[model samples]
Target: MRNPLNLKAPAAALAASLALLAACQSTETKQETTATTVPAETSKTDSAAGPKFLSQPLVKDIYTADPSAHVFDGKIYIYPSHDIETGMPENDKGDHFAMNDYHILSMDSVGGPVTDHGVALAVKDIPWAGRQLWAPDAAFKNGTYYLYFPVKDKQDVFRIGVATSKTPAGPFKAEATPIAGSFSIDPAVFTDTDGKSYMYFGGLWGGQLQRWQKGTYDANAPEKEPSGDVPALSARVGQLSADMKHFDGPVQDVKILDEAGKPLLASDTKRRFFEGSWMHKYNGKYYFSYSTGDTHLLVYAVGDKPTGPFTYKGVIMEPVQGWTTHHSIIEVKGKWYIFYHDTQLSGKTWLRNIKVTELKRKADGSIETIVP
Candidate 1:
């Protein structure tokens, strides 16, 4: 069967699909605050490893795909849409945007070349996968891996689905039905220090943050839908119970931040524009980072808590020679780095490559950008 996100066929497509199905059906949480020190420079000299920072493409010749990376068992695992071919044919329309398969890549160090372990997840295996698989985000808790992905069913309706696996390089198993049931995509999972698990999703239509109860699917039960004062870009945070299933609190808007870590006036035009939200706590402060405009640039904000009166920091990075960039931030061995996709190779969106670079903090506690 043809994959959802349209791409030219490759010799190994069928084998890759089967492998993913076998791996996905298997899997199964907390947050803690730890002190992290900021390093002085972008590049660190190490006698054993040579250099502390490097950049390489994890997956090659795919379309503009978003990536989610996490460290598991001393390895870094990346889950991104499997957009195979360099570009889509002109006549292809509708649901044939690009076919997606989830693959597992790993390395011992942050700057190493990611070795592909073939396909880890695929659409055909899941009864409801339909054809398209959009963005897939994975999180490891309690010895199991949970992968939340967006899929289009046979009816061409888009929604999010969850798959489980025992290992990061998975054989994932699908749930009976989608968790949220909303026409949503790009699902990201986050767990807080209070043992609460939350899932964040949505794009130009705005974003939603829902709490997962100990073992249930009612993310919207606690909070009433906004009666009137909703921002154009939608982002809500709901509390999750310990088991990572169900909701505990009302879903509410994500706190906005100003440049000095203070609240900013909400702008209707700016709400729907921000994309790619990732949360991290550093030095006792919570940092919420996101993408703005055409995906070529990245900006962030900070607060004392996850539900924030966040203040914007500034743009961390922009397109050096590429048009748009999608990124994730990771800290390895006392240093910070940003992993993102860039369009420099093909320049037309497809054939974009994953790039990594050292992240530096300014004297004012802001981040510095790397020019291509």
Candidate 2:
């Protein structure tokens, strides 16, 4: 974790100042600061409160969930879905997964201010996307950055699409159509050591419950994500084109296994993948991580290749403090960090904000469970 530096005051000095403010400043000034403070702008600063709290909640100005982090040109860049208020008055019927756009945030070093590079893509720019634009992931290939996002079609079926830009923080333009053969949502893309890129996605437990039950992602499927939906919630991964705009190979349904190489039983409650699939390669070992159902914890499996015949591992993180937790893991300057979301600002589960914590792995490459 990046330690806070350059502050002129100590912890005691900050406490004394707050105490002095209480004694001398008008009550109105404090109320105004608290109410007017935007989360994105405020969270960038570290305080005398110390290290454990240093590199957390990367932005606070707006609700940013499903953080997708990447490193390019020696800077860490984040592509997170923008969460905002929605319903009919807020939504047609108060729908909750009502995200509309993406914002790119980047930092030169740890414990530094993350500058919002502005809107990278928006629903208004997608010709066929429904109003709800959900979790998104991005990749840098050749000289262009490709954004992979999940959006509901006009018919309400979930589909994944790509957007391209020459710069990392971009005014990314969406492709004319989504990648063919993509059916579910939550698209996460990973680029390997050999320059081969793969996309991982699917979360039937939350959206498409009935259609998922019907055993496919077709029209006339379930209207919303099924409650505690289990059964066949297998995630899919496929190699991407060199341009990163389309899938270039056969997409494979990830059939999770035990360390023994046997398929996970439906009864194995502890090792099922519910949603939020993130793939990264560490030390030649492929780590496939994802959030568990109910959205409070994340777990993973490992394999030797990019398209994994992965074996189930234990939990990576638990107690993320929100109804749902979406995350991404990236190694920044030799330090591994896991980025996820929780409702610290709005105090409402629907409005999750982003947070980051340094992640530790055992000598054998398994991650130690993180209780965030």
Candidate 3:
């Protein structure tokens, strides 16, 4: 039996026939965060020997995946989803990826031990979300830290939600409803240098990118406006409200550009994004990084603005031992780092753990390939 969790197929597919017997089972709530009780074992530093964690899997207490990093309050905070083993029924005996909560890990300086700050958000708190908590991204607006995450709705389709807290390590309270018109997973928020905010969200098997249109998502109904390509394994982008709680304008399809600088429409599933959409702005350019699906390799492209017309660079990090590779890129105190997850620990693709490493770039503004 092929593993059903590898591609993060929409909850619609798994909720009915597969996940009920696997990770999405109702009994699995060991990781969910409650206002009075969060269930992760917190620790500071390396679990093995030396300070190996700074350059390796920093999250050792529990399984974590799809990391998103941010610099706030004089520290670097990483928001990652919690993965668990649900005794999946498959030939590979893979993980059900029963992730239902998130944790924020931080550090005061480079080479310092990463501190697991406990739970940031959880599926049980979201009024509209189901139990399938997945990849998440965080950002600060005004004075609040907003965590953008994805979960299956009552209908079993994936929907994005925004949760807020005053602190980075949060007991974040998800809004009473999801961001009006969002879908899919991995909601990446990019705040441009000009103070404008934008969000890029979606995933394979019907993820989408569109600004807040302020209405409930009707998967069976016609779109409020005709969209270019909102289905399949594609990424989308749009301006977001200052509060980071809503979409403000029309969202457009994210595209990789050719050498001649034109949008490559064929990028929907070829060489670009499979999932895990992350954006970093440096030297007046935008670096769009993603986990190339089916290949489990991390790749990136460059663009002039926050939303692309990005030009595909090359494969940044080669494939790892896992069947899926989801990640994020950030610079803390002038040092760049890539935060990703792998199955090297549990030796099961579904039971992923967080990994971090220094990201080096050449003089020409291109990144050197990483073997990790």
Candidate 4:
């Protein structure tokens, strides 16, 4: 297990700074913003966030979540789900997260001004998409940038799709149909050192991973998890073809194990696989980080190979002021940073804002958990 790093700034000083910022903003008609202070350590017992912020939003003009951040040609590009209010009520099936389009956010460096390059891809342009263009990831191969996303088809079933562009910020052109044998939500592409790329995808509950357990869609799959010590469901991974659009082989299970090399139990909500699978290589170790959905923690596991059998290590970040937690990790200029989202701007789960902060590693190689 990883050890927790306590980096606490004075609460009184932070409160005073927030008050000053709010008092200054009260004179203007703009939306209220928080002080640009680093995230401080908070009580783990209290999941709900207080007035202090871990980091400010990267973009405020539009709600964005499930950030998939990458560095291409020395700049940071974020592919995030464009969140919008549709007045739809919330449910276990996630009807309220009615995001229908995607926008690309770019910046030359961290803490720098970000540019939103308008709409990269929208539901209306994709002939096969039904609705809710969810979380996406991008990759560059053979001089072409490919956008991998999960969207429901006309049959109302979620399928992964691919779009291509010559440039990173794209008015991308999507293929006519979803990728063959793709299912569930949050498609993240990881290109390893040897140039082989793999797509890591899947999520439980509303993400519909539960329905696909039988290798076919079972709409009547039990919504509740298994009882006793039954092994929990895990995320899916597949090797990408040379074209980067289709899976080269069959989708395989990404087994997340415990210290004793046993599958995490279904009742282990605190450490089980939930959603938002991300892979990054650090010091020759493969780090598989993901959100713990209902538990609201961003945790990770370590493995030697691109495809795991990764062992659960520890939490990366605590629950933010939101119900869902999704993120990505990237190393920039010899420094590592994590990009994530929280409901700080709207206080509603569906309307979230993306943020970034530096990620530090301990001397023993375990990650230092951040409490946001």
Candidate 2 weakest lDDT stretch, 10 residues: 28-37
Per-residue accuracy of model 4 over 152-223 as CA lDDT, tens digit each: 888888889999999898878999999999999999999999999999999887788889989998889976
For 80-141, candidate 2 gives per-residue lDDT tens digits of 88776553232212257677777788887656667877667888799888867788888887
Query: Per-residue lDDT for 291 in model 4?
Result: 85
Model with the higher TM-score, candidate 3 or 4: 4
Q: Please give the ranking of all candidate structures by lDDT, highest first, separated by commas.
A: 4, 2, 3, 1
Leading candidate by lDDT: 4
* lDDT for each residue of candidate 1 in 58-170, tens digit (9 for 90 to 100): 44423335677777887777776655442454221213335556665666676554565556667767787686676678887777788887786676555677788887877
lDDT tens per residue, model 3, 80-118: 887766665443212265576777777765556677666
Candidate 4 ranges with C-alpha deviation above 4 Å: 1-50
Candidate 1, which segments miss by more than 4 Å at Cα? 1-54, 61-64, 86-97, 181-183, 205-231, 259-273, 320-323
| Best candidate, TM-score | 4
Question: What is the Å distance of residue 90 in model 4 from its true position?
Answer: 0.5
Task: List the candidates ranked by TM-score, beginning with the highest.
Answer: 4, 2, 3, 1
Candidate 3's C-alpha runs over 4 A off are 1-55, 90-95, 206-233, 260-270
Residue 88 of candidate 3: its Cα lDDT?
Answer: 56
Better of 1 and 2 by TM-score: 2
lDDT of 2 at 102: 77
lDDT for 189 in candidate 1 is 71
| Model 4 global lDDT (CA atoms, 0 to 1) | 0.83
